[model samples]
Target: MELRPWALLLSLLLLPSLALAAGKCERLVITGSPDAPPLLWRDPQDPTHLIGATADVLQQVAKDLGVKIDLLYGGTRSLALDEVRSGRMDILADAPLNLGELDNLDYIHPALVQTDYLVWTRKDSTLAYATAGDLQGLKGAVSERARLTPAFDTFATQHLNLQRLPTLTPVFQKLLLGEVDYVLAGRYSGMALAQTLGMSNDLIAHDTPIDQPGLYLAISHNSACNDPWLRGQLAKKMTELAGSGVAQAALQRNLERWKAQLQQPVGTQTK
Candidate 1:
């Protein structure tokens, strides 16, 4: 039997739609902060360039998945979170999992790992604090909009005179200049920034961690790329990286290299 002309035309038109619906190129926009270095940070030599651990991991994932990534430089954590929530960004890399009641976003299972906050101060300063409570009456700085664990938040509220800053660099600078007695910062970030700013020895990171939480790759609910297959792929890749020790090895090597460079120092100029 011969097919009708109308039916043949319809089939041809629907063929494109079917193809379009299947295996289309997955494009994703990821937002990251320049302050969270060795995790995410702007390249010093080139202001437009972004580089770090999260960046590296995402790059690897993109390679493995055979997809392209568009990187957007987000200056603040709040701005980054907003971009992701608003669907302006497909993913927010290295973001602390804290979307209180916002179900529009879904996080991958078993976060990459936990990150903790450290109290950093200049070495010359004799001031010391055993815990967040010890800072009562002293001025302290924390990342703006940073979701401190309940315990830390309570301590900050009850004891310390907390000052919120948009980014970690300024907070560290303030601590160096005695603008703030101490700055609550991510231990890795604090160390990286200190080295980058030629203040590694100048800034002393305390042994105690104030707060720790799992970090995740947050996907926007409205993102077109959000789907189970994509999520599974990402989770699997993360698991492989973790189980194979690829992530930890990369982190340690990068940290040591960063520390070594800090010994020599570069990019002391701040933005």
Candidate 2:
């Protein structure tokens, strides 16, 4: 009879630990923008997944943490954010820090990469680009879904004449047609897309950066894996990645990868 009571006490002692173990996630699902190349983009051959520098970094992080991560293509940037916000996805592989998202996500420290947002203009244009203020009177175009630094976003909204298009291709097309004076885009992605569209000779990126934003991996607050241990481990690994220069190297490799894909015959280069 005494042994029965001891057995019950032992079961009680183990219940919490067992539940905690059950709660720990062995795999995490991630998603992000499909158009942000060199950083990330939809895998053409496998449209369900994303690939690029950020994908490589996340894969390395998953390897180090002994967890499986799926980098998925969850539609556009806004839709991907919705997926994470709803807890349908566990992580956003390449997210810029946003105050609005803080309620639904916990951004890891030491961002995966910092990219310069540059002003792209036509080769023959005489626009003197020194600062954001200089763009006040000129018409500009950017993707409707593009996110800029808070200060610049607000400045552009209040002081500049800008047009928001559905996608980047048309935005650049408008710039090429002289409908917009200039467009704002990331340095690497803009260069990559220009090459893809054969606008490399006509479009040029300004030397001065408009905004340099750090792209981070944000874990949904609702994720089962959003515990202190996982967040701490991710932050630690990201710090190491930032200092090791691996992310930059991956960016270069993927830039070339994207270019190489362009050279392959139409339907054959769907990766």
Q: Name the candidate that leads on TM-score.
A: 2
Candidate 2 residues lying further than 4 Å off, grouped into runs, are: 1-16, 19-23
| lDDT for residue 256 in candidate 2, whole number 0-100 | 95
User: For model 2, what is the error of residue 83's alpha carbon versus the real structure, in angstroms, after optimal superposition?
Assistant: 2.5
True-structure RMSD, every candidate: 4.8, 3.0
- Taking all chains together, each candidate's TM-score versus the true structure is 0.73, 0.89
- In candidate 2, what residue range of length 10 has the lowest lDDT sum? 143-152
Candidate achieving the largest lDDT: 2
lDDT of each: 0.74, 0.89
- Where is model 1 more than 4 Å wrong at Cα? 1-19, 44-49, 74-82, 86-88, 100-103, 124-139, 145-147, 177-181, 242-245, 252-271
